[model samples]
Target chain A: MSVLAFPPPVESEAAETLRAEVRAFLADANAARTPLERAESWNGFDREFSRALGRRGWLGMTWPKEYGGHERSAFERYVVVEETLAAGAPVAAHWIADRQSGPTLLRHGTEAQKRAILPRIAAGECVFCIGMSEPDAGSDLAATRARAERQGDGSWKVNGTKLWTTYGHEADYMILFCRTSGTPADRHEGTSQLLVDMRMTSGVTVRPIHDLMGQHHFNEVHFEDAVLPPDALLGTEGQGWAQVMGELAHERSGPERFLSSIQLLIELIGALRGSESLAAQAAVGRLFAHLVTLRRMSRGVAALLEAGDDPTTHAAIVKDLGATFEQELPDIARSLVDEEPDLRSTSDFAAVLAYTMMAAPAFSLRGGTREILRGIIARQLGLR
Target chain B: MDDVSSIIFESAQRLLSDLSERVSAGRPMADCERADGWRQIEEMGLPFALMSEAQGGLGLSDAEAFELVRICGRNVVPWPLVDTMLANRFATQGGAAPAEGPIDTLGELTAEQKERAALARAMQMAGALDVILVMTISHVQERSQFGRPLAKFQAVQHSLAVLAGEVAAGQAAAEHAVARLARGGAAATLAIGIARARIGEACSKAAAIAHQLHGAIGYAREHRLHLYTTSLWRWRDEYGTQTWWTRQVGREVLAAGPDAFWPAVTGA
Candidate 1:
């Protein structure tokens, strides 16, 4: 009956300094963005904004400076990320790249791959999207049927579809996880990740998938024997399953996981201000309590990751519980306030509430679904 | 996880484990049992965990003291160890010394005191959930229904899973509060306020689910589940109810204004 332990996040002088710097930067940068746009939070894409962050060396914060990184600590990067997410900064352009792709590449990429790609990622010039979920393989990523065959010329040719690919159309590259060998029955066997250059590839096509929210943030990316050079393989051949599993820690541990509905929360606070409603106060306070706990858990994982702990189960716990909070935020807001959520409303609170309500459904679905994460958690608990 | 902390924690864990086994066997905390438990905890030096060496205390780190509380919570120790530590912390800040007794006077819980008490209570709830969860899981595994062990039911497993999530939430909130208090940051007060509010909110759902999953046996006086659930109900409203802390935290957050809200929380 072992329970999960989330240690207090270790304080750092560097993280404190970076936090102030990032907050100041966000205040200035987000001055022009409306509450509706800020409500979009991490999903809001802005390439130039990403570039501005890159100039400040925030994009590749924890990476080594020789590859255009700032050589900062993970805690320092955490501060920047939490500040950016809380301020509702448009970080979509460089988020996936900075969060997982670059780290994955840094850990497993060849020297050439790291040199060619990590610097651009650090500069926020190169945007990346994940190529994990296929139409038939979402949470069951091992069910991936996307095949990458080795050509006689030593290059690879990929053919399959990747669904729910966020920023697929705008991405400069993708860390494509595909079956290098073995059947779908093999589950996790003979998989490999490809560092596919979207711009250089000719047979790839990205079609936008409008979500329930009428947003074009997601896409269906197709590959038709898309050719990749010999160097495209990340880590080892036939080890993509393990490699991708290792990278889930990076994907799951960020502050962005829990802060998705922060704009709505901020707006809710404004609407509830000076109100004599005890119910409203309690509701908002409950949400804030969840937020603080989630942040602590998330930050604890960040610190654990910094200390070179795997924290895979810890990360899953954060994502699962964090999504629950994110999805619940809008519902709590709707209940506490009388305002009808209207996406096009002139009221900042209503507009943000609308945006949050529409986006809330995706919280548990993205990164990983609640059921899948719970299964992982149950397994971690030795229950399955 | 330092050497001294681990040693202290191990000793406390052993004592608590023994006490927990006895309580499980005894079904509830008798007055004599409660008094003995307090003596043991005081002898373990937990009350002075946060007090300085000059004050004849170990003065362990806040994280270590919180860890001890978490362990005690997990076991449902039925002692006022956390309360004593709170009293000691208060007294160390130039207040009246804890009254001379096996336990110190907790005094009237101010907003900060209430929040601290809430965090301690939250930890207890988390611990109690852990005990109930294990008990329920064991019961479901052993007790048969419909020609199969109750654990075979998907509904039972899912309910237990939900219980696990609640326990996790409570534990996370308590730890977060303790961590913030340990840091003594400007937002520490607000952080504790949020922690108490959230944990208090979770109390009902956690208690209800545990009882529901346990069935009639859970409500029985001899079953031992009542020991935890009843304590949870009592402590949940002790310092401040979720409503009290929520309004307190919400008012502070609102007063800070919308623009300052993000920085207030993040910086905390």
Candidate 2:
């Protein structure tokens, strides 16, 4: 079907009002922190800042009001997310929790779990980390060796190591994905997710792993027989693979996936205003075209999501193309600019360029690698 | 826009589906005699929709026309809906009686009148045309660059794409203007300009791709694709070049400010 056939975004008076309010807040925040000081992924984890957003009912904007959400439309939440990403706000504190965990809990958590956690999560008093990737099992999540054995006392004992856990060290809890039944060869079957309290866990350790940019944004989390109540199991047992995959749709297809390098591009264009070189012009033109196409594709996916469609294949397409553009931005910037990009430079342009250069590699690797994404696309096309 | 559009779309879609069936049943569009093509369009009453009820038309808005163009583009109909609409609108605005039959517009000109006349005759051969529109450019018959035809240059190809885009945009705009004029609104000059710009770009791009793929064979008569692609090149440059419409719309938009540009171009 033609992309244009998709319903145009419905104009909302409430959304427009909220957008204006968000613009005002961003204008103030931009003046204060100048987000360029933060990491490329909007990495300042300010609990207080998150709480402020929560107070305004912006964090879990689309969740049910009974679960401490505003019950706003997904498109409204999309506007907020897009504007936030574009402004480069310090949203990392509530980003994962609000984006995926909140939605997942709403979909599958018990009444008790919802009453206890949803309000706290919406209020930004608690934060969560996804514990799916392991040292041996990265993109191949079905290969997870983490074990959660049922205890006689009606609790579960979890023993596992999850690698590349973003914000794991500071998280209040880890949504642990482990094999609860059957053998390793079972792969996708016999697995379940147990929400383990990071504070109460007896043998839980989080060790920071510095990245190539020397930022301790991710960690290696080890759990040794950490006990959790029976109620800690999210949704049904042995459905962890399905739940995680659903949660990934939220994680993978978002404005954050593509807009990370946009600020740098904007800054680069501002700097290139006077240059008349053919290469520079063509570079800008090519980047603009790619960006437009990406927006069209991404918007199509967003429209589908709003209409309550799965759009998994379309999301995969967006991620694949978005990754390509993200990787190309730095290369284009490097050739366009005459000066060397320095992270410590006082110049905003230099700092943005430096951040994008360091951050571009993770664009495809994080969430899912480019090769893995293409393999998924190939499968969707029935090539495998 | 909502209620009227839904009805128009529903009805037009049914008609287009019926047209598709007819085209698929061993009857190519070119096989239809010129008079037959004219009769078919006249029965559709699409051309008469350009003038007001006072001047004989069912008044429709520019937005409606845009929707119709999108529908037509999606189906790839070979009718001269765009060219006829432009001719009718220009005639009505110029206080000339709207042309009775299919009035086609030409975009390119060959050196000799005979060649031009032959091209016109071919268009007539395919279907009846009341009028033909044409544009002229300097000939590059024997020029070579880097031991090849100058037309084979990458830069030349890019320029052609831009030209095609301009033509497509104009054709779309002119159709839109006709619809708006039928509704007795002030002429949608700006919308027409925007469409012209976009059409020019699309046409040029299509032409360049065709030429690049065809190489020397593109200019040869035996290659049927040239009939469409070359016409696109000629027609794209005829109504208004990309630069011309771009400057016209750009100046209007600048005068109106950034906020008003969209509304002006969209006729919202």
Candidate 3:
């Protein structure tokens, strides 16, 4: 069998209608936002905008209705997401919460925990951050040292730090993956995921870590003696590794993975519209070609995920392939267009180019690095 | 329906697994040899894959027909299944005679015929790449260096992973093109262009890596690698090179302008 066989994307009138609905919303919602701001898209934080989508029933779409979700198909949710990202709507405020937190809670959260958090998440009134990467552990995620020791009263105290926590400062909650019972030498053992409410926790401090682009979204979230109730644990204790792995399929394959650099492609088309260069035309055309294939693969993953199949391998391929296309785009755009990367330029193309060029590195680096992803694929191929 | 598809795929696979050896030695099948392979398939009713029931054909879906073409490509069938399928499909559709014998070279083709042929080539290349990936994996797994198999090495594993990814991408591209082109709408033309262009790129990247991983042995013309690699090198440039399809679709997208670009892409 081929190592990658993504089922063809499923399209329905319902999904297409949702797509149109999302586009109509974006046209009005993104009217005042600058192109540069829209370019940020999923990373462009706007609580009000996230709630607007929530009220429209665009958030927590695939979850069960009892949890305040719309109980829609994954394909329908996928259409809404791709439209949002393709139009570059500001989705950062509720991205993590809607994408992973709610689903993780559905799968692993206790009844009370699900009742308390899922409704708020579905309403887009709550925000969540991932507490995975730490000071000494980025790619070696199992090397996590952040320990959440059990207390005598059956409570838990979390003491460690999580680095590169996106939107940590603004988050109302954080899914804290930490060592629950064992040492760092235990590798993936003795680890558990905790639901840490940022407001409810007293010892948590979120410090801004300016990115290379002088952005302040990523933060260092410190848990100094942060205590949690016994119910804070997500899923079975000591099963953090498996749960996190499941969450990754959600994170790695999505519209945003491929659509992150879409603004540049839009700008490239605008710049190259009337050009007589076949080289430019073909290069630009090939990008769209790659986009469609990646989109199919991603949608296939979504379908598999909805059907309760493990799409981890397929998801990895989408992320890897999508990131490659996204990162290569800026250079291809630069070659086709004469404009330099200028963030402050009056030209929209140049401004989009400037941000995308700088942001390109993170395309492969974030979520999972190039090497790690390839390794996962290799393992799937039975090389390991 | 799926069972019928699989039956077609399996029979093709069983026949091609043996027939591929004729070309694996880096030589075209002689007329007699080609005839034998063609006769075997003719008996099995594969050439009728794309025709409708009224045409006395198997009435397979376009996706299924293209998949048969893909199987032909996988075995490096040294004859003309693609040309025959297209010729017969278009001929019977237009109420003409299907080609009588095993086709080696194509006759005059229309621009639309050419595009369909390109889609066929795209799937063929995808199939050939899939074979190359399997061959490369086998090579790395069984062949050893520095007291361990190449598959045991991280560098080799990573390279093979990239090759596998390319192979998958090419397959997905061809399949995506088939899905859209079968539907036959405004997006069909652009879909083929995109798929063909992307598949050509995949053929290049994957063939090169498959060769690199095989080292000096893969360079041998007698090596079975040549069958798949050479086909990719030739097929990618058949109806159109990567850039040809790219420019064709790109110009259309450009003329559509930035505002209409995304809508055209999604076909919404």
Candidate 4:
């Protein structure tokens, strides 16, 4: 059994070269971008920009070369992700696909399934959305009522609605979770995952759900008799609970969790450069300290992942702490700046403040609610 | 560095496990005080890890030291580990043999005998110092309000979080510095400054909070918790407060420019 240990810090030449290459790419991209001249960080999703990243072989830096990946070390990918998030690049378009979906496919998808989709994802030509949440099921993922029934033609008919689907309307496909057998009464035992081609499906409907900022990032997706090939099943039927739990490990812990609001912090610090107030300095120092702790913890998780360890408990810890920091951005910013918080203002400060305030609520709600995450932690500690 | 750190951490973890078991076995807190704790740490060669091979100690770096300190923080291993490490670095920089036993430098003294005298006075005034390492920035007099202590205020609560952050950062920086000094770098000065600032901040904040929370009772020695809080306040102001180190960091940063700020802070 391999015990989890911190991987030696990336000191090899290849790692350094990758870091330099990524830094150069981010510098150029940050310079060229204009109209959407805002630092949306994790929220900003641009398909063209994602494709550009793909062209540079950055989107799938750590998958097998057979699937159009560079097969780089996870540490190298760690550098790229950190730099990208820190630079506030528009990464949401390919974030889910690159981070978890592609990996999940590699682990569970059949050869035909792999050959058909992995390369396109690696190339950033195809975008994917998670079809996990249903109208009734949020954290209770096993409670999804989306049903898939076997047809005489060796295919499956999927029917139900998924809510809060990020980029559902824009995604080419969705790695969806649905019931293959039994009802919610069976919960984990009968659920399974399927990769559905949104373009070819005729029964699918998508409607944008405007967030507080009026952004159409999330949507309500409906599937009425959507036909999927038998091969669309990601893994064996009735094994989705295990598959998704593994995938959640990937989703929960990452540089993105703690870094979403870092750009705003950088901007805030820049504006406070000449200020001599003790409160402002102390507040900034406090934020920096918390940031350091979050980074250390998140890096520890990454090290665990590199060591091929299950770090679900550690991931939950990072998510909870990260959400707290992200949610506190506006309050911290307000205390630092002398001006009023306004979303519509043309100033960069106003724009970032507005974006952060609007985006902050979802920080906890998106991946997992604070209550849910804490419950997981409590369970891990055997307190529940 | 990686191998050495892994070995040290594993050993430290084992030691902590044993200590925790003992604590759970109804061992009194005072029974495991500085003398025994320092011996255990010394036997583990932690102070040696804080020094360089050139200085007759195990060679390490800031990053390695940080890893050690992080583990220590997570376990909440109560001892003057950070303080002793700071004292060792100070002694090494002064071209003196690193102190072999527990040494708590008095914060309110300067000359060696005076420092010893101050520690003695502190022991007389309050209690004993396993090792008193005095710092240079001692407050002239206690600040008071309306014939009452000035430590009580609603603003103090708001400041505690910031105070904790500063202390954490300072301790982190000190750990980093000792690692650098072990590798034979001129980081002892920086480490001392950070240690002074961090200790002072922790002390003052703890004092303010303790006084506010305890009210007039904090002034009474019978309140045992006050000992911990007051010792922190007195010791914090002994060497240097936040104001002193803030100016020092400012001077260093101004001389180096914004580009060097991160490298300086991170000891890169």
Worst 10 residues of 3 chain B by lDDT: B20-29
TM-score of chain B of each: 0.85, 0.46, 0.92, 0.44
- Model 1, A225-301: lDDT tens digits are 89999988999998898899888878987888888898898888888887767787677667767877788778889
lDDT tens per residue, model 3, A309-347:
998778878888889999998899888788878999999
Model 1 Cα lDDT, one tens digit per residue, B1-268: 6898888888888987888777763456688878887778778777777677777677666676666777777665656667777778778766566544445457666666555666777666666767766776777778888998776666766666666667767777766777678666446777767767766666677788878978898888777787777877887777767667678887777667777776666665
Best lDDT goes to which candidate? 3
Q: Higher lDDT: candidate 2 or 4? A: 4
Residue ranges of candidate 1 with Cα displaced over 4 Å? B1-9, B24-71, B76-119, B136-158, B182-188
- Candidate 4 chain A: 10-residue stretch with minimal lDDT: A1-10
> Among all windows of ten consecutive residues in candidate 1 chain A, which has the lowest summed lDDT?
A375-384
Q: How well does each candidate superpose onto the true structure, as a TM-score?
A: 0.90, 0.72, 0.97, 0.73
Model with the higher DockQ, candidate 1 or 2 = 1
lDDT of 4 by residue, A52-110 (tens): 88998887888899988888887777777777777777888888899989999999999
Order by TM-score, highest first: 3, 1, 4, 2
Give i-RMS (Å) per prediction.
Answer: 1.9, 12.2, 1.5, 11.0
In model 3, the runs with Cα more than 4 Å from the true position are: B2-5, B22-24, B27-35, B47-56
Better of 2 and 3 by DockQ: 3
Two-chain DockQ for each candidate model: 0.54, 0.06, 0.71, 0.07
How would you encode candidate 2's per-residue C-alpha lDDT over B1-268 as one tens digit per residue? 6786567666665665455344432235665553565576677666766456566654655445545544543332446664665456556755878777766653343223222222222222111100001110112224555797544444543333233222322332333333343433223344334444444554555455445544575556654444455445554444445455445544443344423322232232
